[model samples]
Target: METRDFELLIGRNIIEKYRADRHRPAVFALAGLEWDLLDEVWPPTYSPGGELFAGRIPFDRMSSFLEMGCGTGIMSVLAARAGVERVLGLDINPAAVRNTELNARRHAVADRVTARESDLYSAVGPDERFDGIYWNPPFLNAPEDSVDTSIWDETMFDPEYAKLRRFLAEGRELLTPRGKAYLWFGEALGNPALVADLAEETGYDLGVLAKTEMAEIPEALADAFPADLVGGDSEDGEDAAWHLHLLELRPRQA
Candidate 1:
């Protein structure tokens, strides 16, 4: 798709909630080039996670970045759009990888952005290190047996804490010196102890950036997700909310 069409496809949805204050087009700074990317509604099939992931990674000065489970490659493309020297996006889905590549081309960042089909870290070489890494694991209120294991399984259905543990084990090698790996997770799975313990064991200093008490069902995704799983007092504050934590993880050697 052309850059204009691609930008129009995703920008529209983002503007509704994100750019309500701004009357002009929603501008996205990509790889040193500021583009009028958000002026229209989003694509028909865009997932709910697109805006959430994009909102987490600030437009900071970073030479290299890696986006794990980059559906549609939006986050990776946005990173490239932010002037990051290199942006690598990995996903297990073929269609997602293809869409990522298409978005990269549409944004004129194909030369700098890469989206590939592989598990986390499997697609890159050992020497490949990134200055910034951003990921939003799949954390919904479901068990492993009840849920299908997708890239988002890290957050949604990690009953045994296997996925988080694996990432902690190898995170050191993937991050460069002074680099930071930002992870968006929630306490809904009832595994904060496990998460903290694994981080401590791996010599990572974990920190929570922000915790939003979001309603289990946002009316948009309510029909798709089971309501029983999200039956909590979101409005009353006593209800269980999916705590979004931006963990700042660093390697032991660093």
Candidate 2:
């Protein structure tokens, strides 16, 4: 499918799911823990991408961890449970920050996990650094005009990859000498070439750590998606499969 058509389909799926759920608060179970998802916070139950990415984190290798765009603090709490000494979760959405804090407390990891509002690294302390940092970013390249139309848009779209570029550029400064930045990206839905360009421009080497197949249309919005776009058994078929990649970014050697 054409990039524009694919983006439109993703936008439709996001809008339909948001409208159907109306941003209600609910409890969700992930990684055998109950997370209290607050209103207007992105719902992990709506998609398995976050949980799948969270499972890939190497908690045993890190003493301190940071999770960017932490919707419900699932990864932060899980990291603490996995024996990471400290975990910090940051989000641009205040609701998400609060939701993460709620889940941290809910899981009895409040002392070790902290959640705060941040637009990428804005809220991170200059003197502080993490052994591991990761983000499941807003990967879709939505049109500039469609941004900030709703809170849900913040979770789904990153127009022109402005935020993504900053994450790659500015994030390097906040990492420890041996630390690595991990990005959970939807390459099939987003512009992978632009990502590669940005990573190289920012002086980082990008490598794929792991990948998994996810449905192009989220399960909750599967029925709402246009049937015509759903591909079938033909040589020219375009199946509804998208790949989510866990990418490792290391600062380029001198």
Candidate 3:
């Protein structure tokens, strides 16, 4: 299946899921923050990773927050509402930024929650730093020019893993001395070796902070990854379920 069609199918699935639960608003509450997600933004249906990430956040204390790829701004809002000093959300998709800003307004955190259009940290100032950074990056590695990039595809597939690696490398620069960065990761995305090497070379230590099993796998995802890496169900039954994890990455000691 072509990437365009695959992404369209995923979009359709999200719409259908939303319709099924139309009676209940797409509102998620965690860490004392309630998020009202827009239907047009990245659907948070199969997004347990977001909740897991939010749960790991330190609610008792305040810190600056930076969320890359902040879809609908829920994470940023959660941080702001949790009393984080300041929060900024960045995304490549303009609609995501708009949705984030709107959500921030609705949540009455507009003063502290700022949303902007950026690919990675391009829009961030060189001197800026944060006490906390959050990312649930596009995990699938897509071939260059293999698919017509759509919002759905762009949110799900990381072409050549270039952006993922770049984030792993450069994100450290924006972290304060006592700051920590969190990334939601999955075993199905790519070779574990690739992630391991990147973490090592980037001078970060990757540690699992939380984990959740994936309940459903979209068809488009299957096509994007090889059979062996697409799902956690292997013949050996050793790893029967794919797990989504919140990874804590801290700078390695020299």
Candidate 4:
């Protein structure tokens, strides 16, 4: 199927799913950290991308940790628990900010975790730096031509992949001299050209630190995703499940 057709079909599936059941509250553990997340944000149970991202964090504590698009604030709380001196969670949705704050308090990390509403790095201060930064960016490259929109859909759609590239470019600036950045990249959700261009533009070397098998895609979205890209079918049957990879990015040598 064509990319446009595929994107629209995914968009329709997202809208339909959101309208059916948007607010689902659940408790779950990720990378040994317990999370009580509202369905208003991305659910960590069905979605293991966040958990996978949490697992790749360095064992040693850092001075500061920055998390962008902190849906449900799981990573921020986990970062605080990991002994980061300070933790800042940024999200464009006010509800996400509030959710992170609540989660931080619930996890007894409120003292170190600060959640704020910001579109990527816009709200980050000029001089601020972090020893570690993380982002689980919106995956789907869906077009924004649809008339209907909702908060839940934000997790699935990226228009022209603007935010994805912007995050890579601007996020590079927020890293401390010794800081490292990580992003969750699903093979199916991203295009090679965009990824290559972003890496070149930022002058950063992207490396895979870890990977996790993603949950099964809903049957409703089957047609929207290419079977080969999502790893649903193969003669060998080894690549049956989709995988989310943790990418560690750092500046190239001079």
What is the Cα-based TM-score of model 2? 0.88
All candidates' TM-scores? 0.69, 0.88, 0.79, 0.84
Ranking by TM-score: 2, 4, 3, 1
lDDT of 4 at 178: 78
- Clashing pairs counted in every model: 15, 0, 0, 0
Question: How many angstroms is residue 152 displaced in model 4 relative to the true structure, after the best TM-score fit?
Answer: 3.8
Residue-wise C-alpha lDDT for candidate 4, range 1-254, written one tens digit per residue: 66745766666665566456544546667677677766566665545665555656783658898999887888888878878879999988888898899889988989999988886788898889988888888776766775234565566677777778888777777877777888877765566457667877887887878877656774434454545544456558666556677888886656
lDDT of candidate 3 over 47-125, digit per residue (tens): 5455556867664454788999998787888888789978999998898898899889988999999898997899898
Highest TM-score: which candidate? 2
Worst 10 residues of 4 by lDDT: 220-229
In candidate 3, what residue range of length 10 has the lowest lDDT sum?
220-229
| TM-score between model 1 and native | 0.69
Give Cα distance to truth, residue 35, candidate 2, Å: 1.4
lDDT of 2 by residue, 1-254 (tens): 75565676677677666777754558877677677988777777766554565656677888999999998888788889888898999988899989888888888889999888987788988687998888888877877775565667777788888889888788888888888888877755677778789989998998888888764566665675567765643346656456778888889977
Better of 3 and 4 by lDDT: 4
